[model samples]
Target chain A: MINYKTVNDNKCLVIEISEDFIIDNSDNIKLKDAINKIESLPEIAEIDFDTTALKSWDSSILTFLNHIKSHCLKHNIAFIKDSLPGGVQRLIALAEAVPERKGVRKTEVNRSYLASSVAAIGEKVVNFTKTSKDMLAFLGETTIAFARLITGRYKIRGSILMPIIRECSVDALPIVSLISCLVGLILAFVGAVQLVIFGAQIYVASLVGIAMIRVMGAVMAGVIMAGRTGAAFAAQLGTMEVNEEIDALKTLGISPVEFLVLPRVLALSIIMPLLCVYADLMGILGGMIVGVFMLDLNVMEYYNMTRDSVSLNSFWIGIFQSFVFGILVALAGCLRGMQCKRSASAVGEAATAAVVTGIVAIVVATAVITVLCNVMGI
Target chain B: MLWGFKHLDIKTASITLKNLTEREIGDIKVPPDLTVKNLPDSMKTPHIIVKNITMAYGDLVIQQNLDFTVNKGDIFIIMGGSGCGKSTLLRHLVGLQKPAKGDIIYNVLSKNSDLEQNRQKEINFWNTSAEEQRLLMKNFGILYQSGALWSSMTLAENIALPLEAYTDLSSSQIMELASLKLALVGLAGFEGYYPSEISGGMRKRAGLARAMALDPDFLFFDEPSAGLDPVSARLLDDLILELRQSFGSTIVVVTHELASMFAIGTNSVFLDPVTKTMIAHGDPKYLLESSKDERVINFLTRGEGKQIV
Candidate 1:
């Protein structure tokens, strides 16, 4: 809403700003146009501001005045600012108090695509090595903490262990049951499709039972726990880190690994084999449901077939894999949480990383256990 | 008449400026507890009155029976050691947290009411509805200790946010205002820089710039010099004084820093952590010199290398 009147007062150029000098883009355009006009005017030797009628102004007016101040300076014209308000004078004085440092402002540098790509790859490589080293060191710390825990030398509140065990077992049962059942049904359904072509549709029982007992139950339980319990563990510890609660523990002569990580790892490792056995039963029941209704098989016959298909070694192998998986998931979650940077965003990233790392560790462990069992003729 | 919604019958500080001259602010009859001798008389008006205030978080009471008058243009210090509820008191005053009991009345200059009658209409700031609380908050601004600048936004964008949300100013005008405010705090030409890109002291200055963007009648700073070197802290202190002089806004600072308490504080309340209540109330320097309370004397004289002058 700023309005200016240009008066050539014979000796100097007086641009009198009147009304509210609330400068926006329109005002900037007009001011630029005014500057252009002044450039064309050879008779104008000096620029003086006349703001006697100006009502109220803010930073926009300051920027406008600053613009004129610079214009006069660049053109070797004398600039007078006595007519402006006292606040305006003080403000303009403050703006020019410190000059901007040279080379302080960021000016983008041009680089070749090849150079940038190479640099990025080099940085990623360094990061990968550092991350692997850090992870190995964390594993060593966890092992020492576990050793101390086994010796009954940990500082963890003994009261916390019971609740954590309950969480990983009892609280996890319903979801584990639901997923295992659905997975069993899918396997039966898929096996029936192939077995019907050979007029041996009853072989679907053997397929579902053997798969659940040997590998599927443990893999499913591991993946579920990785997403469920692992994410929760990471989030809880990451938040504790952000709040400096973990630091408080450390300063109070308590090791974070022993007090926080040891119990979690132990609880999950102890409960996961039990959950896998429970999951194996649920998966077999699911296979029985499909066999009884869809395939027109009697309940007793399907049950007997499933019992014959599942051997002691196969069941034990699955339980062993689940036990290892429990350790891996808990370790991954706790490690990422403890390694978190002290920020809200870093806590979120830690939780996400924990889930990814937990699932990856589970898959790799499953592959190793399966190959060892196959090669050793278990 | 700032917001001018027929229901929102609020008069802003700017609208009621001329009426302040007629306000009987000079005759502040100091209660016995607040009387500290050898204090100068000036143009300070009672801005906020906290009477019989009890602040608590759920069941735990932080401070009790708090009664104090914060005057206009006064740099009031809420001084105490750690965990003494200084920040809690600030939160209560700013309406961020509700007091457990009693009233926080804003003393405003009534337009047509008599000077004495105007005291009756002093709005109860503590128990207002959410809408009215938001409007009432416009009279004051706060600079949190962390410099609570939105990390996602650049300094200019951060400063521009409140202006954009409240005012109908054009984007270009807002940007210009943002630059001017930044320059006022010696952050000229750094408008495009994000908070993470700036130094700690610069971020604090940027926060001060945002706090001053509204030119509120009152400003609250929570531990303004919590993490800064001596030179930066001194510069911040000087800048605060300059801001008070220029904007003429009453400042309420919650800090335990003795240097800042001595440097710019005009009035102060000493809250004792152990006593669980305010032990002293007056000018910081005056209390340091004349207070008879052992705890007050000890706290005020802590870490100073010499005896009281």
Candidate 2:
């Protein structure tokens, strides 16, 4: 028997197979409807497939269940496949015995395991604390060195500031602005499509406002900055390290981190906030166009909706996220720079690594923050 | 002075002595108006001291206990076989590596007379400060082995980089300085060219101009004539010598080319790639004559150039 029911205020569509059968062609149009209905109720709690009643299910049934679980999972629901019947349990055990699927789960387990292993490897082979201390010490020294540089204690003229600013800030503006507008347009289009179907066309403004101020603006700004600016920082410093320019700095009584990484980090940190603000304006404007033309909403109405929907707190939160992302980009860039080996190939590797690492960090941070804020009812 | 010398030797892990007494070493006479003290302020401090330095990267050892003094107004050279660690030793001097087993003391020379203050300033000056470091880097210039000028920058922009980064000079002033440096290097009116637009020799010259932009006192050159034709190499060697005479700057060059070595190396260090050690020091011709080391003899008297089959 396939017992399908709505649970937790229709927040979840639970499809339970609790019968002993092969479930051979299991063509049920009603099951598809049940799955579709789950999306209508956004308060999805849990999608529990208590397969304990299932005995000797067919391969197609397993496939359908897996597909359903994945879909529910995507909609932000917990897909729990609880206690299984003997035959089904035996089949699952046998599948786990297979090499490929076994390795898949193994890898899933191994990822977290490997992350923890870094601590172990760092502790056993390397002096974890000492290495950390040294890194921190290096950063500290770099900070002090940079402080001297700014105060002219090292006698560096105001002249050096211009090139760094030009390269790090001014040169980055065009790319940042262009990418922000595109991101805004994309998000607006997506939000308009969904809200239009519901005849809540004016809600497109609210969608764009909330999404841009909460996620897209800061995230896209960060990603763009990482690609354009972060990689540039890494490549610049990486090339210096490989070509001995960094060493030249050392020999000139200059700190490589202070002279190189500090300026980049500071320049990026200062610019990211402004970039986020620009991105927010562009994204909202993009949504405004979609709302006016496609969603049949007036531009003034859209603007008022956006203003009413998004709060300063949300704006601040987005900025905060972008600030964190900016710091991460710089940190990753600088980290890549310092880690670069002295070779031509190593410089390229560091640049690519900085971009990849920066993007990945941004995504993970966004997900975690979004989930955390949701849980906090913020 | 003796203790300091010991420390210096232990730190640099390498040395080059004239060995013929100070009188035998001929000094090139320059125009009296050019004083060594007027060299770029970048070289005021002894940022790095490489003494008796022995370097080995993996299995490739470049030099051992090689002693050399890189003082203000000194233009130094480390020349050897193709596999020799001239570049490696140069890398070591710049703190790319910790000496396998020696000291590479890096610090600015402080003008303050107090020992503690001097030490603090030296350490702090080298340790903390981004702006100062950039100016200092601007103060010193390097012509890379491949003339690794940024591909994105124009010739004028490339030359103007140091000036832009470290000087308050306006764009016009930067342009003037860049053009002047380019002219000095014999590449006038090539300001609009990119690295790809220029010939290899011109690129190297342009690189040299960039290095000279900050009016640096210490210049590090790696095989400045490596891939150039012999005529170009000779011209570069002449340029190196002229730079010394005109600027009174300290230059450290890494080259294995015999012609360039003899042409511009007033004092030199010879590294043996095989043993990863400095088997000879002093004038190139003297190392050829007075040294009992067979490697030195064979290297000096190989009769043919590196191109000989």
Candidate 3:
């Protein structure tokens, strides 16, 4: 364990960090508090992070030091870590990158953070593609396995289908419907707010009809499923992968794709359409809520406008897009699971990757389809 | 250890699968032609020769220049450190992974060749179809370290999974066979239970039952004793030895458990951590007692008191 303590000398304030700082979170907190105190005191000029008393410290304490540096920069106070250990120098350098007294705006900070996250996501996607060949093979093999499963041969009348429906489909409906309804209400309300300024409040019904049928329903369904079902699938398969059950299947000549991936892919592919249908209905219902209660528009008037605006082709296109999104989400989840490293942490990471990748795929697909339809004058 | 004991009663927490009667277990009597002890004598031409096979992930070389032969019916055990490529070697054997640099040649015998060729053909029939390969593997079973039973399936369903996939048996017949397997693994009455509902040891047993479902000729185990307490591990080790004696199947085990190594490995291969090479290969007792190799000596005699690196 490392400990750190700061002493106020006549010329300089000395901060002593105990070696047990690595094991002690309180030490870090105290260090931060001390830094905060020194920064607040106008008399203090140079602050020395006294690592002579330091025994051990993890990278986390370095981050806390970074916090201190930031605080010092805020106050135009110079922070010195001359006694800092070699291990924490890099962190200090990184934290010290920002100059003193030139703070970023909140929006700029958010955008920079967003940009870094996006870059990280891009790197992950590239990395995923490297391992994707094996995953593709696994998926192909799993597809074959699923086809075999559906041959009506492995019927023990066992409780397989119920779990699929309960866990993957039926259980997901209420939440899916609820989220879709909320999204619809928000969209309609936003449209109403904008159109009422132009004396076109009634056009909000048409906007809701077009958006729900073409974009919102499928996109929202895909995003939610990516968050919910996609994560579940990855977690399930990842747990199996970590447990070596997949290897057991391989050794038994039982293809994991057939045994594990197939069922999940099939379940997701089948359940996705249902989810989309539910989403579309609920979104329209939400629109109806806004139309009647919020927008002061009658329910029948809203329905008639929706009916006029939404064609069978429009509805079908949305449904078809959702179906594609479902497959992509399922594939992304399964791929992540298949690519999962043989560890518990790997499983968790794979599950998170599944959801993230699924949402990205959804956004890209939705954008492409929307653009394509606009170009074709649909 | 107390936590292990506390988990013993977990089997009764959920729905249990039906067990098969003693008479219903499928009888498979196959001779064990592949014992590691008889590798030099039995292998006229090595089926799979691993010579100086070096494998690494990034900067760390898991195994290097490994020299070994896997012949028909050879129950080979590869023992090493945690990340020492024991599992990687098994993956190579199963053709799931290619070595970093090594040749794995498979001898194909054609039917139209001469008399000697005919004999070779008789010894080895070639089939390219995946289904055919699967059918051949039907005679093999694999028990994983973590006892990878399917979470969704009941114990009975898990055991019966292979039969359903490859066989034409009715549900009743599959259940009966599955029960027999369950009984063999001491999971007779717990067939309907899901993997989540069962204890770890029971799940391992269940995995073993499922592995044996196809009546495989070769059985592969990866860290069979991992994550288990001494008592459960001992029970599992005993079970492994009993199966080896009774079934006479080719058992390839990848484990570093010294107790398990000494107990069941008739012949074993010692994988060195530093060299990433096979330091010794022979009977465990002989290698431990007679080998002058420092690594081998240190590895074999190192008691459980020393923590594994």
- Best-fitting candidate, measured by TM-score? 3
Residue-wise C-alpha lDDT for candidate 2, range B94-189, written one tens digit per residue: 444556666554334333454333321222223446555444444457887777766656899877766755668899999988899999989989
Q: What local lDDT score does residue B246 receive in model 3, on the 0 to 100 scale?
A: 79
For model 3, residues A222-278, the per-residue Cα lDDT tens digits are 898899989988998898888777776775676666556666666777777777878
What DockQ do the predictions score, one after another?
Answer: 0.01, 0.13, 0.40
Better of 2 and 3 by TM-score: 3
Q: Order the candidates by TM-score, highest first.
A: 3, 2, 1
Worst 10-residue lDDT window, candidate 1 chain B: B6-15
- For model 3 the TM-score comes to 0.69
**Candidate 1 lDDT by residue in tens digits, A1-378:** 334344665557777777777756677786787687678776777777778888987888888777877888898888888878999999989988998978779997677999889988999998998899999988998898878767875545445688788888899999999999999999999999889899887888899999998999999999999998998889878877775456433322246687678889999999999999999989988988889899999988998888887799999999999999999999999999988897999988999999999999999998998899889999
Ranking by lDDT: 1, 3, 2
Ranked by lDDT, the better of candidates 2 and 3 is 3
TM-score of each: 0.53, 0.60, 0.69
Per-residue CA lDDT of model 3 for B216-295, tens digit only, reads 65688878888889998898888877776777566778887887888777667877765677777766766676666766
Q: Residue A25 of model 2: what lDDT?
A: 51
Instruction: Name model 2 segments beyond 4 Å from true.
Output: A1-204, A240-263, A285-299, A342-345, A364-378, B1-50, B56-62, B68-77, B94-98, B103-141, B150-178, B191-196, B210-219, B247-251, B303-309
How does chain A of every candidate compare to the true chain A by TM-score? 0.83, 0.60, 0.64
Q: Residue B112 deviation, candidate 1, in Å?
A: 79
